[model samples]
Target: MASSSTNLNAQSKFDVFLSFRGEDTRTGFTSHVVEALRRKQIQFFIDDEELQRGEEISPALLNAIETSDISIIIFSKNYASSTWCLDELVRILDCKKRNGQIVVPVFYKVDPSDVRKQMGSFGEAFVHHERNFPGEVRVQKWRDSLIQASNISGFHDSRSFRNDAELVEKIAEDISKKLEDLADPPNFDGYVGFNSQIERIKSLLCLELDDVRIVGIWGMGGIGKTAIAEAVFHQISSREYSNHFDGKCFMRNVREESRKMGALYVRDEAISRVLGESNLKIGTLTINSYIWKRLRRSKVLIVLDDVDDNFIQELESLVGQLNLYGPGSRIIITTRNRGVLGVNSIVYKVKGLEHDKACELFCRKALSRKNRSDDLLELSKKVACYADGNPLALEVLGSSLRQKSKEQWYNKLHDLTLISEPRIYKVLKISYDELSPKHRKIFLDIACFFKGEQVDNVTRIQDKPTSLRYELEFLADKSLITISYKRLQMHDLLQEMGQTIVREESEEPGKRSRLWDHEDVYDVLTKNKVRINLFDIIFLSIHP
Candidate 1:
């Protein structure tokens, strides 16, 4: 029953460090556990004879325990008999205390009560150790390590599990679950205003609910909808529901994935991920049945980010496939379009950062140090105002102005007023360009002439009630424009970008599709001739 030395280097680096007595379970129970770990593709380190013969645990074994995120201590009949195994136990416990390493004790063919109390074989082993090395403090330390490790809630093979095979499977399953949790950490560095939003969303999640709760986060682009969702998802996965949920997955940029590989592909991938399977090729025709059957008893937390109308439809179909889910399951969707959310779902509208928050965000992005010169602070506040609380605009403008001189800041601010900054404009134009031709025309008209006009007046001007209504809905759904208090409302930067797009069409105002400038209007009127077709014209006569 002696264990042979195997000096194989860890293939993907060790994730789980195995500590056990080789002569007792190395050939039987421990071997089964190693095979299970291999099938699960879990990296583990188990020492052989070459490592076990030293006066103390080798540096390689100690280093492995220190580096590992998790340690599995297999306590068999004679596990505590060997001084080497006891040394490993002490080192593993040390790692658990200092490095936050997870320690899982599997009582193989041994009772946890016996291990904790140092009774039966464990007591006999301690007596033999004391006699062999009298007055040694190491024996007491080994006993303490065993008691501490055994007290932790872990798999008890003799009491619960039927056999070694079943025990191995359960151990592998627990390891996989813990590994999934350790994979993703919350990333909140330089992330501003995320906590309040996450708190609101968490309130809406109501994790106490047994039934599936779907929460929607809707807002315009660059408003931090996805960022908020990601932060919340990380919190839920790693903290709140880490041990409770059966599985979790965060599918990011769903719109991009849908465009790259259809909505059904995204749906399949999400289901596969939450189900802990990879390359699961379920056809769209039968995916629903497959998902429902697989997830029926499982509690999961899923986050679908950057969803759009098309992807939402696919998501609906995917959810429809699931017949039932375990209680306490939650799904969070982040989308720019409110209409994409289910009517019954609670929707949180993410708005631009408040003035103070916007200023803080801009300053953080613009200045390297916390202490700022008065002039730079003034310039930052002015830029924040120009950004109008848009997170992306603040970031882009702040980064562009970082380390620039005060005069350069003034020059940049002036340039921003005249034309939209390219980076900010490019992002704003995405929502604009997604509009249909009719919707695009309506958005342009609102941006150009009717931004603050009454909605009724704008509708009358357009003179197409049915088309205008539909286009307005489309524009609103796309987060390009808003109808508020019976008036058309649009983001200032969006309006500027729309105007810039029109200006780009023709350098001469007379040759453009729309004319709003005073000099251009005067020139066209004074010429007493129309050179080109004009979509609309506005003229304001001055009172002398």
Candidate 2:
């Protein structure tokens, strides 16, 4: 299950929020709907009578409406008559506009047109309120809220169903089904060559057993450890199994976060997310027994991605090892070093894509052309095999050769002879540093300025059209770039490296080789920054 803090810190407290006039349907239709939703095991919020007594919406009710993933408004004939219900509708629509909350307006025993146009009972209610309320603006706002809510496509109780029981059941089931999207499961579709590893990892997890298990997945950088863990997490935690773990957390890029922040913060964040709580003040000096008791009682699934030897001990030192979690709990730790998890830990080693699988994966990314000639297919197979089945290398090199001519393919293959299969993490940087001075200049220009420009337009803008193509050819040969769909495309790593190089060229933006950031360009043009460096910028192009 996804925690409340999954997306943008939006803490979702309830799956559904029910808004209705208590006096009209509290004992009849709303009761049946609540019972049906309970039978489906859906969490919802239905306002009590105390909430309806106030002229303004209560803070608790407002919070409930704000935190709910979906709002179901029972628009009975007398729904608009209650000022409290009108306020709730306005807030519900406001939430829908602010964050993508789902709103279902059920028109019960009322004409849709009447609610939309503020006619019939809706209009009568508004007229009476407009006269009774001191301020006319509030009443008008309610009228506008009704028109907007009624315009949305939702359940029509009278026309869509035979009776109230059937309609209530349908509503509960539909809402329950819609809540599945909130889980945001990792998608394996369109991904090739991952089934064998995913299945093996699942079998190692041993979720069927009653004992707790700690599985460590270790591989070289860029070997698909994170992808495999994510797929396994989605498969086991999915709603298909009723016995899924009570709590689950996937902490991504733990190494990166530890470098940027501190290890203590990262450890605290992992614990809070796994327990589905916020503001966990678990100090290192004094650990609470209550926290340990709760951890020992609840089943948890945690993925500590990219951790080191010291960090594992840092966590176990506080949580009391496997004894902290309940039986049947599973913790998956991914790292580049297998020794980090200590000797008795169950470990899985991930190898790169095999021969045939590597070729198939490479062809999927590289060759989109339907009419593939024999020579092109042969060259592609040779290049993929040259990558030694390393997924990162194959993808980087394959993408570089996409949508190019036969002669260009031969030249790219020849360039591969100049370099061996380098390590995956430094592949982009090593390729860029090896380029000729002119090639590097052209590459940076495209990276900083014309990323998505047409080939013809870029050449036309350059000083020498013929020489520009030569530089582009070498860059593509090094697998730093690829042209596809009539557009020049460079990898994201290349762009970041180029920008960093230019940034370090000089402190002053105007004196730098390129200007991509808008604020820097504006300051250069408007503020007249004095260039203190003796060197002049070789090329200047604003980011397009």
Candidate 3:
């Protein structure tokens, strides 16, 4: 179960727990209500809250209900007759008054007059209980409580028959708003969705039709490309469907684990961890067989982060070793090259943050001094503009600007804007400094000429690029380099950083080139120029 703090900290979200009599109407009204909530994207908890014969509500369930933002009580005809239902109602109403738990009552098929007046079937049940018990005042008191509960001003009077989407929709809307108020706060928590540039990848990934769709997300260093893939991974991992896997595995970097840890090491470790073994050792072939057998029985969510595009064949071998997976089973690869993912699959090219989101993110980091003056706000936006929404650049500037005044902000912005040169490479190098030589070369080539390029391109570029690819991928994966879809397109900020590393590595400055620029005019004249860009480029060509 996810914590309330996580849902609350996330922007504009809420959780609702529905309290309903399962046997009476779970398949009918309750199912429709739950479906409606889902269609509206309202998160809710509506599992059977009933206790089994000799079971009582556990501490976990009670706590979960208490922590939830709102509770909906479905008051059907025989609701008050059941002691269990009555107890749940009492608890819900108590929480409503004390802890601000919102409780909405829906009188299903039962008249409000009969409930409040206690004159019809409601009165007979209480009367029989009184006569049969004779001396139990508790039964009489429960009857009075039920009558009082029905008289509450917010109780819905009408029956929720079939074909009431409009009415149900209105009630759901009201509940949704209350839940939002309780769940959302004035400011944002650190957790955010993938950057906009990475979102482009998600949009494209949704379009593929393969039974085994694979996407590789790739980018340069410190560009937040890996963060994007991780965000999506976390998102999908939490869904109920993810439980189909024996267990999801996150392989940090392919090379180190494959080399140092080894396939046997991973299989043994994963099985031990899942099955709770202190120390277990099996032969490599046996371990491999066990892993494949386990995978065949379960749908797995595997993330291979930071891979060498050149090791495409090695990747094929790994996936080939496994048995067939279920429909939703996914394997995500993050590399520095796009071509490694194959042309038949979807390819997502991650870029940098848009100007606005980058500005907001930077302000949160830079303007740590709570209160910002109007003058500072203007200056901060200017500084963010200079960063160009590149996460690396934003962090660099923001970290530098912490506790600084408006004048300092202007000074930094002016210095950055005065130069025509981009700062992505400079920002990325800070993260690259920590990588090994194998990873450094991988990062550089990917940043410059290899981004969105195929696995063959790396081998074509260098004689031993494939051998180095595995090691490079391992480094990038561990360091959280971006890899998704089949190819690699580093965030702009990371590309800039990679370019900076290339410049520093080379003895001569003139040797480095920007691949995106048009340096060869005659080649463009001879060729059609292809007009390759992001989605907008494709859209413009179609519209033009």
Candidate 4:
């Protein structure tokens, strides 16, 4: 019943801290490593929430790593690039010296020499930073930290590490042995909400991180993008390898603002803080570049949550730059926009719950009822139809109706139509505005007459409506509405929302158009005997 975070905070024996480049391992090996730890019942934390303050690690982050029993550093190519990762590496080494905290290394794609001496691209990047901040103590510290981490034991070469699965088994076995050695183990009960979905995502991350392939999960807003990323992170961060890294996790939430001082910008500061450096030249390094550099040789999982469509481009240059820390280094990105999908990232479209699942969810919130009632079931179906399987809408409406009775449900149900308002209207209008004028006209016509009316009958009432079928098909493709067996059913609430917008847009007298039906017009039309008289009389609803 307690939240995982609550349980983790209450514990004194949190197990492992996972450190790595999310991009390199998110879709591949890291997932496998994390799953292995989870299977063995390890407690850990892996953060993908973007840092949001200025260029310093918050006190809370420092405490999380300090509290962990061990740190796992998955060294990939870009590990050295992130100052945050460098600082975490320093913390782990400090813990090693100060408290004998355990440290494990998975030598992803980079060599020990590279980490030890800062050779290859890392050396060049550091040298460039040293030059930029000439004679800076922080630069010297960064160099020293890299050397110290490279010298640690428990190294695994990803290039020569044949059979990723077998390697993962060995790693898991080693972690289990380490757990056996620990005097105290943390209590971990796992995460809440959609366990199977989390497991599936973790599997994908493991395979992707192991193979050093990129993977992305894309979907609509609040479709659990960040949640899935967080789930995969917890799965891996609890492993034995995580102890080798400095901190439990580094999270970056990108939704706040991509501008200066945003989450990504703040993560840079967090890196400096975590590294225990004062006034480090953090900004000279790109955030993603810094993340990659620090995670190069360490087994770590980094999460880039709520990324924008442009996140793919920002990471393209750094993908090949990471050390490929075998299967333990991973990055998971959560976004509502689908454009973030890339070749390195496997893109999964997260859909809303199916009807039955959504109905169950609705009942739990709406009626304080989980059991399906023969009578309530039909009303629930009608409400679900109005929601159109959107979990947020269903939950909101259900919560609103939780204490209401059957009569209240009936009144609301009667008002509910092929069209809806508040939520679906604005969303549909955005989609509708993108259409051509002819398409817009057809959409508006359907909202007015053809909504509940038989499509064929409505079409017959309008001259040349047959010519609009192509536009209608286009709208259907975009999921604006559904047409089936010549019976057109609007996405219930969306139709109402669109009708409301149309009504507002026609409020200007010069427009001389009406979207809603008024009783006065029906009465006038009924009283009129001739078509000219009908025209003279403005039946506001019928628009004759």
Which candidate gets the maximum lDDT versus the true structure?
A: 1
lDDT of 1: 0.74
The residue-by-residue lDDT of candidate 1 on 215-294, one tens digit each, is 89998777788778888887776644434787788887687557556788888878777776644667564545656766
Q: What's the lDDT for all of these models? A: 0.74, 0.73, 0.57, 0.59
Ranking by lDDT: 1, 2, 4, 3
Candidate 2: list runs displaced more than 4 Å.
1-69, 72-101, 104-127, 130-179, 182-190, 318-320, 369-371, 420-544
lDDT of 2 at 120: 89
Clashes of each: 1, 0, 24, 90
Per-residue lDDT tens digits of candidate 2, residues 1-544? 2212112122337778889988889999988888766654566777655533555765666788898899999999899888888988999999999998999888888898898888988889888897898686878888888889888878854667989988887787678668876755554422458799889988897888877788889987656787788888777877786556766778776764564456677777767766645546565734578877888888988888878765765556534367778898888888888777755468999888887888877776678759477778788888776666666667766666677678877876776656665444344454466567877888888877666667877898668989888777767655677674356776444566778889989988888866766567668868877442221222233221
Question: After best superposition, candidate 3 residue 279: deviation in angstroms?
Answer: 42
Q: Report RMSD (Å) for each prediction in the order shown.
A: 18.0, 12.1, 18.6, 21.3
Q: For candidate 4, lDDT tens digit of each residue in 369-415?
A: 45456887789887776666665456545654566778877766665
On residues 321-404, what C-alpha lDDT tens digit does candidate 3 reach at each position? 434554445667777666666654456656666666777777776776565777777787877776555665666566556776
* Candidate 3: residue 375 lDDT (0-100): 76
Rank candidates, TM-score, best first. 2, 1, 3, 4
Q: Which should have the higher lDDT, number 1 or number 2?
A: 1
